[model samples]
Target: MIDWLDFVVLSLLALGVIFTVIRFVLGPKLSDRVVALDTFNMIIIGLIVFLALVFDSKLYLDIAIVYAVLAFLETIVFARYLEGKNNDNS
Candidate 1:
């Protein structure tokens, strides 16, 4: 059965996503937007973990871990692109 704690955690995670999305939308710089995107990915990962707990399924946890790895790679790729762009500007 779902509990209050789960609900509370899910609520917090949802709020986090909303705030990060706002940041992503209002970013004055591309770097700031990239960070916001990464943060959004992290919050989604948290949601996946929450789903896994609620469903009592290890598969969801596994999915979350794989998603986390992908998100990390995505962040690295964005950072590299920014770095190259900055170097070209200099």
Candidate 2:
């Protein structure tokens, strides 16, 4: 049976997606868009974990872990590139 917590988590995920979309659409800077994308990725990881717990799926949890690692790597690479660009400009 689906619980209130599941519904709440799903709702939050939906809200996060909506906000991410807004950021992507209206963001004035590359960094702002990157931050929004990072948030979206993290939210997806959280949602996956939540669903895994709800459905008792170890496979989903494993996939979530993999996704988290990839997201972290992406963030690090973006940060490094942005920082290098700033350094070059200065």
Top-lDDT structure, candidate number: 1
Give the number of colliding residue pairs in candidate 2. 0
Top candidate by TM-score: 1
Off by over 4 Å in 2: 3-5
- The 10-residue segment of model 1 with minimum total lDDT is 1-10
RMSD of 2: 1.8
Error of 1 at 26 (Å): 0.3
Quote model 2's TM-score.
Answer: 0.84
lDDT tens digits, residues 1-90, model 1?
A: 548888899898989999999999999999999999998998899899889879889999889999999999999999999999999999
Residue pairs with clashing backbones, model 2: none
TM-score of every prediction relative to native: 0.89, 0.84
Give one digit per residue, the lDDT tens place, for model 2 in 1-90.
658878887897899899898997799998998899899898889888887888897999889989999999999999899899999999
